[model samples]
Target chain A: MSATFSAQDPRALAEAPPMLSLRGVTKSFGAVEVLRDVDLDVRYGRVTALVGDNGAGKSTVIKAIAGIYTFDGGDYRFEGEPVNVTNPKQANAMGIEVVYQDLALCDNLDIVDNLFLGREITSNGLLDDETMEKRARETLASLSVRTVSSVRQKVASLSGGQRQTVAIARSVLWNSKLVILDEPTAALGVAQTEQVLKLVRQLADNGLAVILISHNMNDVLAVADDIAVLYLGRLATQIDAKSVSHAEIVQLITSGRLDVDSARATTTISTGERSGSESTDQGAI
Target chain B: MSTVTGRDLPGLADAPDKRATTALSDYLAKVRGGDVGALPAVLGLIVLALVFTGLRSDTFPTTFNFANLINQGAGVIVIAMGLVFVLLLGEIDLSAGFTAGTAGAVLGVAVTNHGMPWWIGVIVCLASGALIGLVIGLLVARLGIPSFVVTLALFLALQGVLLQIIGEGGQISISNPTLLAVMNSNLALWQGWVLYVLVVVGFGAVSYRRMAKRRAKGLHAERFSVWGFKFCTLVVLLGIVTFLLSRERSVNVEATSIMGVPMVVPVLILLLVGLTILLNRTAFGRHVYAVGGNAEAARRAGINVANIRLICFIICSTMAAVAGILIGSRDNGVTPNTGGNQTLLYAVGAAVIGGTSLFGGKGRPVDAIVGGLVVAIIANGMALLNQPAGVVYVVTGLVLLVAASVDALSRRRAAATGRF
Candidate 1:
């Protein structure tokens, strides 16, 4: 159900600039247009959950933000300044980090090495393992990650949740401003899912802009401050997570539109007509 | 995703003294989890030594035979060290043998035909080797061709080139005394002991410095006992080997007493130490492991994966070339088949048997030494027993198979235990 402040939310006040904003972002593969005129904003200190059904262009939108693919026609504004980010390296230079669904991590390397994979700490042309290990330890500690027994353990030894946390920590280790997580909780167990969700919330709470892409409604509702729904390569709606109900979000996902009156009427009819359905059902049978 | 606080984990608490216990348990757990490392190779070495010594009591462990074994194993060791880099990246160089052959031919032609100095011949050999490597690297890295195919093609083409350079039945004899002395000559007794002492002291100093530095930084350093154990092992091993090499091996009045460590042994040791540092302590080495472990992950981390692969290929070929030079010196000439036939296979076998994985991301330079020695010992011991060539081949093949099996099984075990 839409709330009273659904349309007049103070987030739209435009007093402070959004942390990152994309306007009319379009991406096409040959003749197939995957994203069309998409507009989204990731505000500071907030979690923006990007939710959509399969093949709904959610991945395309995040990839564009992650600079894995350049938008065909759009303006990418980071902190209200237009910037060109054609590659992940450039995106990282601008403090944009993406933790992909695969959690790209070297399984043979230790946690410290994985955290500082490309950008290693070196002294006198030799790897400074001490500094890297110390920093990795500090980063994990700051995130309150306790599942990992030791930072020197190979990634192959870590659990799925621990790997996800390492990936998350790695993204934010280099002063990232916008951290994007793709299906972070999809493969995790319940306890691990809860831990990851808590970490995601903590990321936003620490004044970082976190874009969480997930299919689980409960997880999104629990951690996300705002929900942006994508329907068939188009933005269906952007709404506050607190104002949306499960049924309403489901309806929006399936139909790409929200009919408040019809949704409410359908639920009421289903519940209220149960007692009267006995005689009508016998007659129909 | 469970929300257990750090305090909830008993052993994970911030206890300063628990670092040693955690490290020790972690190491034990790793071993139990199938990260047996060099243990298989070490045990294999001991068992082989015992068997061979029992069979040929007069020659197997004799000072002369041991010195000869080191000399023969040195070429394989150097070549296998290079293969370690390529293997670490989950790639192989099938052309290493022929590449070494070509290098030897080039050196032979330069020193004999062109009358160049021995050092110049060495430089020429290395450059040609590097050039060969560069071409292969470009083909593999830039063209995205499979390394197996690229190296196989090189293997065939290099053999042809080597044959053409040396001509039919044309073997160039090595005239430079210094070049031949690498494997033929032995160090003086005093000099041998001096080098041994320096190596032990150097290793001790470096280990102590690194441990101190790690401790000062409040990082996870090795336990003092572990360090001490390693130091003691090195001293004892080096002491025995050096003592054996320094003894005289005079079989008859006509034969001069050949005593002291072979010059090639020290050179091989130096190369091993250098490569160990490169692989374990440098950024490039770390990148190699990363690329081998997961190329996509390395690329996503902004690493130039292709570049790393290219450099590794170059290193492999160049080292193959060096091995060729050593072989030529040891043989006193460069034949057309210098590095051909079973040379490359033996080098690969040495690396794998020494504990370097064919699957990659799990090997060290020390593997070359250990594995190469095993290969050498088998060939030498079998020869001493007057065994047929076929038997030697069969035994070596079995060893390689067993090593590969060990690698595969341990990998599966590690996967099962959720560690590697």
Candidate 2:
């Protein structure tokens, strides 16, 4: 998995510019500052994994990027130009789409309807069902998604993985430049998870900047080109996935920072004893 | 890494191979899985007809009785149709009855007292209804007030307004022959036949065009046999109704031909068709279902959830106004008691009985028609048996309970089976 990351160091690739970059982004609700001085960069044609423990403000960062919440203070640069996105509509207009964790799909509606919902294609004052269905099929086909039996099948009838794929496909359907997927595989089975991870890789390969928010270390390690770790409302570090080991990432997540040599020394000592107590101590911040 | 297969790739060619269940079996499975759409209502209608036929064979199946039954059902049907929209959002409008009365009162005051043209009065009534709905919608959607509470307040307030408008006499005779003809008149036999033919042909053409479009797009379309069966059933049903309505029944041995379909039936059908199109084939309709299904999801999708809720409420109240006009026409005037009593209850009952869910997002416009007919049949059958009003009320209550239970049970089944 690390070999895949080494084959493509996303930051070193100068062909695609950074699609979105945030510097000194701060957000607070009342007196509680959820995110403070968070800096992040999402480059086009690259998969950037944002991973953190609970209450680490990973969601706050993604929400800020998706424009679900306004940043109290920040410089938001989109493709080398500074921009302010006050709402989801403005973000959408700027070609930034968020595939939320909940999937945001109507269970009663069919795939065709769900895919073209809110922006239905109408010809001569009536819904052009045929055209919409055809477009939905074409979009799914482009993604190589073929598990769905029919476009007319309702979302409720779909499996967790298929629903995730449909949601992801919907975001990209509107000519999205940056797709932020929040825990795309959190509720999926193993096979479904594999399919979603593949689709995520395909999105980045298709030259769309992808920001994946996930808790699964394996998923992040397997697909991410650059892994950005958040710890306690602050960005601990952003590092290339190939250069880091599992214990190093864990140490960074739990303690907000990692002394690489000390972490290696601790790992070596723990391996000899194979004691759980020492491992826990090593994880402590 | 595992190789991709049809199970993992939904758009693959082999995906269809896994769906080996034939269309007929699939449909049967859906029915068995408790997706019996309007079957319960249709079955109830048939059973009611049989029971009435067994009890009062002489009068129950007569042309005049059936016509009168439809005429009486028309107002409730219209109201129920409006209620379906509200119910689809898992919301209730307790004020529909009084809203109807308010519109009727407005119509009466404008046309009779103020000497406005009947059409102008109708416009005022409809506009007033929309305004009332807008207010309730704003209170419910914007202020976050519960619809039950808001509509309940409107129910009381509107009833008082109706009473004030009618005054001590408790009635305002319309005196407009044109308005009275809306519910009291019938289409000629030829006209009724022509209307039925036009409807049948229109439906057939639409079905064919849809199938052709699907086929052309290489999508899964309904089979020819399925379409034919549906078309034939509709034709046969219309034929039987036309035949029954065309029969002339003698009044007091005077051989007075009170024949042909009631004028309101065709009007109701037109409204039903129009609403069905709006609900099924429009972007606004899609947003409505989306909001009803999951408001949070709809909001995230950039749909204005509050706006959708407001529009649905407006549709409900506007429909109530239309029903109000029908009620006034049927009674030949507006009375203080016009939309009081069990009218709102009956409308809610009809929508639920026809399979609209109380938990929002799982019903169709046609449910109103099916449920409305069921309520009407019960009332008509009871009246034919010379049953007291108390008995009618009890029976209606019991049926509503049964319908609601069926809805709850079916929802549980759908959830258990993982069917939407």
Candidate 3:
């Protein structure tokens, strides 16, 4: 659907344009405010894990980023440029995709069909099955997906892990620059979780900005390069995942503060400066 | 025609097509995998056929009865074909029977009362059917009303529309010669054979072209042997049907010699092929399945699911109109009872019996044709044996129940195997 399988160099990503930066993003439903003054920064070649407690506005932030909800007030920037995305289609058109936790996949359709669901390739008004099949195979192969035997196997016949992989792969299929995943591992087994988390890291490693929302701090700490925590409808801090500990993330999630009134306390966004634990998490991913 | 019959040998390694033995085993494995596409319908047809062949019907064994079976089943088959669209969307059109009746009444009124040409009447009838479908579709897709409830309301309302069209004449006897011929006439014996040849050759040409195209792309195509066997089997089927239909079906050879395939056969075939292509080959068809399987997913994929649902309803009511006209032409009149659940239930039964999943996203138009045959045979055989209408209804109902059971149980089996 895009130009070919071109991945930007991870090393060059530091100098690359910023993928998505939200400044003072606010959302409300009638009288109740869900999110207020939320500042989030997602960069290329990095997984920004957006972890929060239940109803801590993590979903609201994701929906807002995916253009499922309109921000009551905010500046939504894409690739260092300002743009208003009022719908999911606009987000998709801007190379932004949100893979919801429910995994919005048609079980009756095969991998190829599912991948090209609304955007089927047509020649002479008929589905160009061969071309689509070839591209699906190429994409899956590039992702090193081996669990699936055939591209024609229906989504229903796939394991939870494979389905998750297909869902993730679909976002990249369209040359997406920023992907927001919501609770991807909540229903998956441990092995599938590992597989998904790896796929998530690979997305970032391939120079795409990835936003992951999960309740599990372990998953967030293991693969994320920048972990953004939200608590009580506000972003507490966006810290370098490498610099932060699992307890720090948990503390932020619970209390909406990284540290007690000392250094690196709150509302500070950190960069990917590696640490002792960060290298191990990188290897695990 | 079956989408379930394929191997998934991972990446670029194109799995070679299996031989006949492997193909057979593969089919068995597919059945075990809860993808029993049309097996039940085929087996049901055979069982019903063998039982009726030696039963009390003097005409059931005749070539005339064989031809009669086609005519008797054509209307239901067409309706069922249309129903496949709605069913594929996991939606129901309960008013389809009456929609057909209302549309047929429009034709009858246009031609018989207003002295319009048959073609104009046909257009008017079809448009009316489209309008009816549009209304039902709007209610379901736009208003977010359940299709079952919306159609049920139309089912009652359309009956009144038909009654209003009949205008206390009690019935409208079709006077147009062309309209009458749709159900009463037949193709010449030579024409039937020529059509058969053309169909076979066309199928071979289309299939081989597709295979060659895939091969050109360095992609796996169905094996020549596998496709050859399928072609041969289809040819044999058409050959038998043409040969059987070409025989002298009239009691007296001179008066009304019905010795060719009925015109309805071609009509049925045209609908079958067109709808099949629409479903299996087109983007619209693919989107329909997507919407049915998971609408939220389809919406995220930027598919206009509501539009798809609306179109499917339109197709259903329009096909139902065609069926109504066919039945009206066959009966030579549009009576008050011209459209009823007797037909809708049979068409639904035919669809389900042929393995078109009521749950949607797992059906083909061919399923309707096969299932229609099973329903027709049951009805025809029961009629020939001097069985009352009650028996026919009961038997048909039981058959549908069994088919639905198979569907539900297989769905469960599929879920157990993670095909859910």
In candidate 1 chain A, what residue range of length 10 has the lowest lDDT sum? A276-285
DockQ per model, Cα: 0.34, 0.39, 0.40
Candidate 3 on A102-178: residue-level lDDT in tens?
88999989989999988899999999999998788777766657678778788999988999999998988887888
Candidate 2 pairs with clashing backbones: A145-B11, A146-B9, A146-B10, A146-B11, A146-B12, A147-B9, A147-B10, A147-B11, A148-B10
* lDDT for each candidate structure: 0.85, 0.84, 0.84
- Tens-digit lDDT track of model 2 for B1-420: 112222243444422222324667978888777677888998998998899999999989887788888888888889999988888888999998889999999999999999999999999999988998999999999999999999999999998999998999879988798899889878898999998899999999999889878776666677777778889999999989988888785475474557787889888988999989988888888888888888888887778999999999999999999999999998989898888999999999999999998889978878988899899999999998999999999999999999999898888887767566
Interface RMSD for candidates 1 onward, in order: 6.0, 6.0, 7.5
Q: Write the per-residue lDDT of candidate 3 for residues B131-223, one digit (tens) a residue.
A: 999999999999999999999999899989889989877999897889999999999989999999989999999999998888776666677
lDDT of 2 by residue, A219-262 (tens): 99989988887777777777677777787888878886666566
- Model 2 chain B — which ten-residue stretch has the worst lDDT? B1-10
Give per-residue CA lDDT, model 1, range A187-253, as digits (tens).
Answer: 9999999999988987776667889999999899989988887777776666778777887777766
lDDT of 1 at A160: 91
Candidate 1 differs from the real structure by a C-alpha RMSD in angstroms, to one decimal, of 6.8
lDDT, ranked from best to worst: 1, 3, 2
For residue B220, give model 3's deviation from the true position in Å. 3.3
Cα RMSD to native, each candidate? 6.8, 5.4, 5.4
Q: Write model 1 residue lDDT over B1-420, tens digit each, in one string.
A: 123233233333333333456767867887789898888888898999999999999888888888889888888888899999999999999999999989999999999889999889999999999999899899999998999999999999998999899887678788789999998999999999999999999999999998888878765567787788889999999999999989887677376878888999788878888899999999999999999999999998889999999999899989998998899999999888788878889999999998899998999999999999999998899999999999999999999999999899889999998777
- The clash count of every prediction, one per candidate, is 4, 9, 1
**Candidate 1, which segments miss by more than 4 Å at Cα?**
A1-16, A262-285, B1-28, B253-255
